[model samples]
Target: MRQTWRWFGPADLASIDDVVQAGAEGIVTALHHIPNGTVWSPKEIAKRQQLVRVRKDGSPSGIEWDVIESLPVSEDIKKQKGAWRELIANYKESLRNVAAAGLEMVCYNFMPVLDWTRTDLRWGLPNGGSCMRFDINDFAAFEIHILKRPGALEAFTPAVVEEAARRFAALDDAGQKQLARNVTMGLPGSTESMTLEDVRAHLAEYGNISADRLRQHFIDFLSEIVPVAEEVGVRLGCHPDDPPFPLLGLPRIMSTASDYQAILDAVDSPANGMTLCSGSLGARPDNDLPAMMRQFGPKVHFLHLRNVKRDSDAISGSFFEAEHLGGDTDMVALIAAILTEEARRKREGRADWEIPMRPDHGQDILDDLTRRAQPGYPTIGRLKGLAELRGIMTALGHREFGLQ
Candidate 1:
C-alpha cells in the first residue's frame, strides 16, 4: 500500500513539513477553497499542488498531492430535487479537473445528515493525547434532550430514552451547549456548519426523504457521475457512515456491507467503490472488518486505518483510540490481506493497483499540541501508526520472500 496523509491544504495548521515528517509520500487533499456546486478549474488544482510541493521540507522529496479526500456534494444534489441537473454537471466537471492534475482516486461520502459524529473531539486517552469517538448515550442526550428535535427519541429504545433524559438533566448549561455543538457543527470536509436555527432549517431540507429516498438520490447522482469518473480515470470511493447508523432525525443508508453491495450493484462499475474506513464501520460489532476486506478487496481503491475499543456496557462505553496493533480490528491480518491483493496485482502486471492507505484518525499528542492541526490529525500519532503498519508490512513481505 502507498501511504498518504489527509492535508486540508496550505492554510491547515499541520504543514507539509508535518506530513513529510509523518512519513507520507502522498497527500490526500481537496480544493476546499472552491465552493460547493462550483467547478474546479485545472489552474486551481495545479496551484494547490504547487503550494504543498514547495512548502515540504525534505528537498522536494516528500508529499505529492495524489488523491482528493472529497469534492463536496451539494445539498441540492443530496436531496435530488430541483437544480440537480446543474449540480451533477458541476460535479462531473470537477472530477475531470481533478483527473487532469493526475490524481487517481477521489474519496467521498453520501451520508445524509452528518459526515462523522463524535460526542467528544478531545476524548482523553490514558496514554496522554485525545482521539475522536462517538458514544451512544452522549449522542442520545444530544438528540432527545439538547436539540430536542421531535421524534428523535423514537430512534432509540425505551431504555436508551430514559437514560438520555437522566443524562440531559445531569449536564450543566455549558455541558449541554458543548454536546449540541459536538453533534450539529460540521467538522473538516463536512462543507457546512449549523447553528441551532441552521440545524432546524437543514432538517427541513430532508422533510420527506426517507432512507430509501436518500439512497435512490445517491444512486442517481452516482449513475450520472461515475461514467464521467471512469472516463477521466478517477475512482470514486464512497466513505461509510461514521457511526454506521442514523442520527439527528436524518436517514443513513450506507452503513452496512449490504449497503455497500447495493451501491456497487446500483452503479455496477469499477469507478464506484468503497473507501473501507475501519474506524467508521468497526464501531459496530456486526461489521466483520476482515470479511469486508476480502469481499470488497477487488473494489477498494482507498483505505482509512484506525481502531476503536468497543465497550461491553453499550451505553456507557467510550471508544479509546488504540495503537494500530492494539485495537480489536486485527489490523495485522487486515494489512496482510490487502498486501496479498497487491501481490496479485503485481503478478498480473497491473499498475496503480496498490491501494492508497492512510492512518485514518490519530491521537492529538506531543509536539502536535504546539501546531494548529485539526483534532485527531496530530502529526505524532499518525506517524506512530504509519511506523507500526510499515513494520508489520516489512516483516510480512520479508517472510513472503523467505528473507531471515
Candidate 2:
C-alpha cells in the first residue's frame, strides 16, 4: 500500500508541512470550499492540485494528490428529488474534471443526512489521550430528547430507551446543547451541516424511504455515474456507513460486506468499488475485517486503515476508536490480506496494484491535547498511527506468508 494522508485545505489545523514531516507519500483531499451540486471546474481542480504538490516557498512537497476523500453527493441526488438530474449531471462533470486532473481514486458515501455520527468527539482515555466515541445511550438521548424525532425512542431496545431517558434527565441545558452539537453539528470534512430543525425536516423527507428504497436510490446513483467514471478512468469507492448501523431513524445501505457486494454486483463495473474503512465497519463485531478484505480486495479502490473497539460482540453496538494495532480488527491479519492482494495484482502486472491508504483517525495525545487539532485528526496522533502501520508493513514485507 502507498502511504497517504488526509488533508483538509487551507483551513485545516495541520499544514502541508505536517503531512510531509509525517512522511506520507501522497495526499487525500477535496475541493471542500466549493459547494455541493456545483461542478468542480477544471480551474478549481488545477488550483487544488497545485496546492497539494507545491509549498509556500514554491518548492516541491514530494507528495501529490493521490485520492479525493469525497466529492460530495447532494441530498437531492440521494433521494432523487427535485433538481436531482442536474445534480447528477454536475457530479458526472465533476468526476470528469477530477479524472482529467489525473485523480482516479475517489471516495464517497451513501449515508443519509449525517456523514458520520458520534456522541462524543473527545472522550478521555485512561492514558489521558482523547479519541472520538459513539456512546449508544448518549445517541439515543439525542434522538429521543434533543432532536425529538417522531418514533425515535421506538428504534432503540427497551433497556436502551430506559437508560437513554435516565441519561437525558441528568443533562442540564449546557450538557444537552453540547450533545446536540456533537451529534448534529457537521463533522469535519462532511459535505453539509444541519440544525436540529434541518435534521428533523430531512428525516421527515426520508420517513417513507425504506432501506430497500435507499439501496435502489444508491444503485440508481451508481448506474448514472459509474459509466462516466469508467469512461474517465476514475475508480469510485463508496465508503461504508460509520458505526455500521442505522441511526436517527435513517436507513443504512452500506454497512456490511453483503451490502457492499450487492452494490458492487448491481453496478457490475470495475469503476464501481469500495473504500475499505476498517474503523467504520469494525464497529460491528460481525464484519470479519480480514475475511471481508480477502473477499473484496480486488474491488477496494482506497483504504482508511484505522480500528475501533466495539462495546459488544453484537451486530450493532457502541464503539470507540482504538489504536491502529490495539483494536479488535486484527490489524496484522487485515494488512496481510492487503499485501497478499497487492502481490497477486503485481504478479498480474496491474496498474492499480498498490492501494493508497491513510491513517484514518487517531487518539489525541502529547501536544495533541493542547493543539486542539481537527477532531479525530491530530498531527502527532496520526503520525504515531502511520509509524505503527509502517512498522507492520515493513515486518510483513520482510517475512514470507505466501507472498509472490
Candidate 3:
C-alpha cells in the first residue's frame, strides 16, 4: 500500500506542507471548484498538479496528486434524467484530461441525494474528544420533524421512531436547524448544498427509482464510462454507500459485497474497480472487511482506511468514527490482506501493484478540538491515524512477508 493523504485544495485547513509533515508520500484531491457535468480542462488539471507539487513560496512539496478522491458524479447522471447523457460525455472527457495529466485513479460515489449523512458533526466521546456520528434517533428526528419527508415514521423501527419523537420534541428551533444543516451538508466546498425544499424535491425525483432501477442506472453509467477509462489507462473506483443502508426511504444499491460483485460483473473491465472503504463497509456487521478485501483484491483500485464503532449489532444502527486501531475493523488483518494482494499483483507484473490508501477520518483530539477543521477531517487526528496505520503496515510487511 502507498500511503496517501486527502487534500481539499488550497482552501483546506490542512496545507500541502502539513501533508508532507504527516509523512504521506502522495496526495489525493479533486478539482472541486469545477461544477458537476463540466469538463476538467487540461489547463485546470495542470494548474492543480502544479499546486500539489509546488508550495506557496515556490518550493517543491515533493508530492504529486496520486489519485482523485472524487470526480463528482452529477445528479443528472445518477437519475439518468435531465442532461445525464451530456454529463456522461463530460465525465468521459474529464477522464481523458485526468489521464493525460498522468493521474491513473479516480474515486467517485453513486449515492443519491446525499453523499454521506451524519446527525452530529461534533458528537462527544468518552475520552474528551469529538468525532462525527450518525445517531439513528436524531436522524429519524430530522426525517420526521425537520425535513418532514413523507413516510419517515414507517422507515425506522418502532423504538427508533418513538425515540425520535422524544428527541424532536426536546429540541428548540436552533437545535432543529442545526440538525437539519448537519443532515444536509454535502461535501465541503461543493455545489451540492440543499435546502429542506431542495431535499424534498430531490426525493420526489427518486419516487419511481427503486433499488433495482438505481442499480441499473449505475450499470448504464459504467457501461458508458469504463471503456473510456480503459482507453485512457485510468481506473475508476466506486465508493461504497456511507452507512451502507437505506436512509430517508431512498434506495442504497452499493452497500454490500454482493452489490459490489454485481457491479464488477456488470462492466467487467479493469477500469471498473472498487474503492474498498473499510469504514463505510464496516458499519454493517455482516461485512467482513478482511474477507471482502481478499475477495475483491484484484478489483480494488483505491482504499479509504478508517474504522467505525457501531452502537448495535444491527447493520444500519448508529456508528461513530473510532481511532484507526480501535474500531470494529481488524486493521491488522485488513492490512495483511492488502499486502497479499499487492504481492500477487507484483508477481503478475502489474504496473499498478501499489494501491493508494489514505486514513479516511479521525476523531477531533488535542488541538483539533479547537482548530475547527473540516468536520471529519482534523489535522492532528488524521496525522495520528496515518502514523498508526503506517506502523501497522511496516510491522505487517516485515512479519508477514519479510519485506523490509
Pitting candidate 1 against candidate 2, the one with the higher lDDT is: 2
Task: Please give the RMSD of candidate 1 to the true structure.
Answer: 2.4
Global lDDT of each candidate: 0.80, 0.89, 0.91
Model 3 per-residue lDDT tens digits across residues 1-404: 99999888988888888888888999999888887789999999999899999776789999999999789888888888898999999999999999999999999999999988888999998999999999999999999988888898899999999999999999999999999999999875564688999889888888857899999999999999999999999998999998799987989999999999999998899999999999999999999999999999999999999999999999779999999999999999999999989989999999999999999989999999999988999999999999999998989888556532
* lDDT value for model 2: 0.89
Error of 2 at 383 (Å): 0.5
- Model 1: lowest-lDDT 10 consecutive positions: 312-321
In model 3, which runs have C-alpha deviations exceeding 4 angstroms?
189-191, 399-404
Scored by Cα lDDT, where does model 3 land? 0.91
Record all residue pairs in model 2 with backbone atoms less than 3 Å apart, i.e. clashing: none
The runs of at least 3 residues in candidate 1 whose Cα sits more than 4 Å from the true structure, single-residue gaps closed, are 56-62, 189-191, 313-318, 369-372, 401-404
Candidate 2 Cα RMSD after full superposition onto the native fold (Å): 1.2
Q: Candidate 2, TM-score vs. the true structure?
A: 0.98
TM-score for all models, in order of appearance:
0.93, 0.98, 0.98
Judged by lDDT, which candidate is best?
A: 3
C-alpha lDDT of candidate 1 relative to the true structure: 0.80
Residue 330 alpha-carbon offset, candidate 3, angstroms:
0.6
